[model samples]
Target: MIVHTAEVVRYVTAPAVTFEPLRDGASRGLLDHYLATLAVATGPVGLTRMIASTADMTARLLDFAPDALRRIGADAIIADSAEPSGPIIAQHLGVPYVISVTGLPLLEEENVPPPFVGWRYRSDRLGRFRNRGGYRVSHFLMRPIASTLHRRRLTWGIKDADQPLAYVAQCPRILDYDRQNLPPNFHYGSPWRNSPAPLLDPPNGDKPLIFCSLGSLQGARKKLFAIMAKACAEIGARAVIGHGGGLTPEEEASLPGNPLVRAFWPQETLLRLCSAAVLHGGFNTVLDALAAKVPIVAVPIAFEQPGTAARLAHFRVARVISPQRLSVATLVKALEEVVHDPTYRDMASRLSVAMEAGGGASGAAVIVDAALSKLP
Candidate 1:
């Protein structure tokens, strides 16, 4: 299977950095961004139109590629989400394709709305209930129509009928993923997060270190930063925050203290030397901390975070404090608990061992390659 992956990419600075849009306000024109980025990858031209979902966009793709489709031939395309147009093109080209759900809820589950909805908007019991209805609607109505369109057009002369699989989840078996009555073909690949950056070995620098970040989606708000600054100061921990979300000039200038506060740090790299992490509880951050064997003081901003926090509590690995109801006192206390309490550290250590047991990238790569091998 020659796989083609369709996912969103954004460069707040330059040169185009590709990241999952699991956070809020990260991508304004997602479809446009994906269509542009997809062309950058090597693939067939006619199929690229199907990937872009624009017959016109195919022309632009074709101009760059003289007889690209004829040269590449038919290969399997694995789309990360229904959001991407690869399936549409795959159908038109009669080529095999797969859908890869990058996040938890988007993974092969019945009756769950997009997790991105949670970060962008408020969710409740009623909202969740409504999502169930909407899930049913899309699963029954929209999915079939789109799937039919894809199959009819592109898959006409496709050699392998069963080559294109349904859902490929990027979940590690080490984590507590809900694996119920999933089909044999419904696969869980290795975590892409396993490509952890090389640890910088930040010299442990003499103070109790706390890794702090509100997440890239939720940028550095002065109020939140101020509160965190005060809390970290009280707790006597050096703070390091990431600037992935693109802070403004004033925001950059206004960060509390220089020697103690860092503007940016590689997440996995920092996790190794830090005593504790104070993050907005994005799934990636949470999983990275678990992989690094570090305790977390999760201040969930929205959506799956609350559920993620609940899951952490269930796992007995970390503590959850809602940013909405959280105070400097509560933040300070949570930090103290994670930093001082042996239990939190022990649980984190245990979970970390479990996470590492999967063997990171190599482990995940095996599952993905197996699925692809079965395709043709």
Candidate 2:
């Protein structure tokens, strides 16, 4: 996204788990493992895993940072919010740190549903109560890791440190959400890449095209793809399945008709040509489809996917199918509904305009620069 910019620190490797230079569907397993674990998004086990993963990731990055510091004589640290350790590291170095988030900025708010629950946004008292309880549970799960981080901070020469967002009050937050949707504090910048992405050849077919993938994490669902392929066929649609290493060679060979199974494909290129999409409800994929003005059939299998699907469903841009009820018939029905209805596409188009105005990655850079300029 900083392709047009003159000053982006190109770090090929920062986190121990990195995804590939994505073409279409390569499965970088470590990246997928981190993401897939969060697919659950809620629950005691899920929260514990997320805490552990982020803490480990933070430590790894810290080990890598001294080299980065020496190489650049670094000025400031900007971190993805999920990691939470970035700000602390910067604190140890006596440098300002900014947080960048690629999702809703509300975090755990009483008025909104806790993320990934697929609950509608409501101001009702009951909704607030539900959110409060959920947030408390998550905080409880975080205590162990929080305590560990607390000790780590002392070792890092940060004698007094708070949790990640505590720094945000004093730093800029470049958020990947719309101004209309986000609270006032976050600077809304779209996560979609502003630079033009190269395209791939569309699947060869006269039928309405459907793009399908579960993304990298939680993508090893061969059964889901099989159902999607079958449903696409039943609906007289052609699906190009960017399996992301999800399907077997035999499974790919046995796909009924016009279902193109590949390791991956240029997703943006396909989205531009697709009539519909069947996706795992990953936030990035959803934003990509929205930017392309494609309607979606969101089957949320894990993590914040259900919440992402809920947001789309709330916008009337998608039809959400819970995994428990996923079937060829239901999937087919959703495809037909979206492809035939102009409303879904129109809603998606509207979101595209709003998100496009959100300044994408370049906008994010501008925010980061502004944050640095004010640093004392």
| TM-score top scorer | 2
- After TM-score superposition, the amount by which residue 371's alpha carbon in candidate 2 deviates from its true location, in angstroms, is 1.9
TM-score of 1: 0.66
Candidate 1 residue pairs in clash (backbone atoms < 3 Å):
50-89, 91-150, 91-154, 92-153, 92-154, 93-154, 94-154, 94-155, 190-364
Deviation of model 1 at 267, angstroms: 1.8
Q: Write the per-residue lDDT of candidate 2 for residues 1-376, one digit (tens) a residue.
A: 1110111223333343232231222234555466567655455678678768766555555555545554556666666676666677778777666777765453655786766578877767987788788788667766756766677777777776543322132111221212234434456556545354576454565788899988865566778888998999998888889877766798788877558789778887778989999998877777788878999999987666777788788778999999889999899899989988999999889888777777766676676777677646
Q: Local distance difference test, per candidate?
A: 0.58, 0.69
Q: What would the per-residue lDDT of candidate 1 be over residues 20-88, giving only the tens digit for each residue?
A: 222222235645554444333223453344343443333323232222333556465565554434554
Position 249, candidate 1: lDDT = 61
Residue 80 error, candidate 1, Å: 0.9
